[model samples]
Target: MNSPEQVPQDDDAEVVEPARPRRKGIYALPNAVTLAALFAGFYAIVMAMNGRFEHAAVAVFCAMVLDSLDGRVARMTNTQSAFGEQMDSLSDMVSFGAAPALIVYEWALKGQGKWGLIPAFVYCACAALRLARFNTNIGVVDKRYFQGLPSPAAAALVTGFIWVMDDAGFKNVSTMPGMPWVAAAVALYAGLTMVTNVPFYSFKDVSFKKTVPFIVIVAIALLIALINLHVPGMLFGLFCVYGVSGYVVYFMRKAKGKPVSVIATSTDEPDERGLH
Candidate 1:
């Protein structure tokens, strides 16, 4: 038998393993904005503790603006990531949930004992529940409406009351007759409404990239001018109306024999069967 032909292998040729894919690094810009929002919430808490209620309220509002921007920034830059989503949620819990609850409690509810603690705790709990539900039901809900009031808006309603009151020289009104009760009512309404099935307009359909009629731009400008005339009063009034608008829509829909739930009527999303 002929000697088996031995295949000559070049020892000089190095074996090359498949090139490992590069691990993605976390995006910094949006997360930095989120951190700023978190700092604002912490600052609000600190300011409230120091009796600077106006500053605290302002800080919370600042947090709200920053909170609104981070997600849009992430989307615009194509830097969306799971890490960013988680970071955003935690930041919101601070800026919109805990900060407002704590600040409002310090502002007006500190003296009511358990009665005071109840609304604050309720608001905080509702915020947590709302956020959890939002994350779970995102794909099952209508994009045009939130299943409940957004936490930032709820926080706005709560803190907006404080800001308007404080701006009107009511910083010391925590001791005023019926003031704490009023605060409690506002907090309770905001908290309870958050867990409701009422739908709040998400404004997701409003596109900054799309052109609008000139009248709309004019109306926006006019609205800004009006708001600037009395910042606290105007903003508080707007949020107050918004806080109740969900219930208004719910009732209207009910009366019209239309579905009131923001949860979409989709058979495809089986996971949403038992969800409210």
Candidate 2:
């Protein structure tokens, strides 16, 4: 018989190592939120197919809200999982990538013939690349800034234009004089910016759980009221500013000689080449 200090390797010796616990079933609550977002994305695609472009745009926005909530909820409840992350990424690609690309293509770019499809495809492709890069660079990229115009922001840039234009009495972008070319420009701009090296503030530093003065709540209420007063105008204006905000950040960083590129220097991860 082997002494207690002498670890026995014989098959007859009783194995004493601790048994590893089996993983429990997937956590439900946070992933439920992710599924809800996925449903919203699917709803957007269906609505777009039905030619109710306005409803589709709203659904995409709803997905954005739901998507934003899931990660936070996961963190708060200790329910984060690989499944949830993968689901969220897939949902974002549909909601923010394919959905916006198709909706805009159907609504406006379809009129531009072959040229229109080009920008829409570019937008869709860029959104995919952005999401993939985001997944691979998690915990390596700076939390305060995104490496590029986020896929959602790009979607908002594209769809916000649609929403505001549709609300502004232009039922079809092609109907407006010179609007087809303009829509094409917007699509290309939103797409290409998503893959650029410029940085956009991620707002990750803001802790939702932190307590603040009563005035902050008051400010939020005021903002909500403002949005209610002119929903399309307000939202479109906000996203328009955000669509161009990365360049503003980039130039400001250059002026101050601060780091303009978001690539983390000390990470062991391989660089994503050819992204511009």
Best by TM-score: 1
Model 1, range 75-132, lDDT digits (tens) per residue?
A: 9998888888889999999888999999889999998888889999999999999899
Q: What TM-score does candidate 2 reach?
A: 0.86
lDDT, residue 195, model 1: 86
Listed in order, each prediction's TM-score against the native is 0.88, 0.86
Q: What is every candidate's alpha-carbon RMSD to the true fold?
A: 4.5, 5.2
**Model 1 regions lying over 4 Å from their true place:** 1-24, 267-276
| Model 2: residues with Cα > 4 Å off, grouped in runs | 1-25, 268-276
- The TM-score obtained by model 1 is 0.88
For model 2, how does the per-residue alpha-carbon lDDT over 32-84 read when each residue is reduced to its tens digit?
Answer: 99899989888988987788888888988898899999999999888888888
lDDT of each: 0.88, 0.84
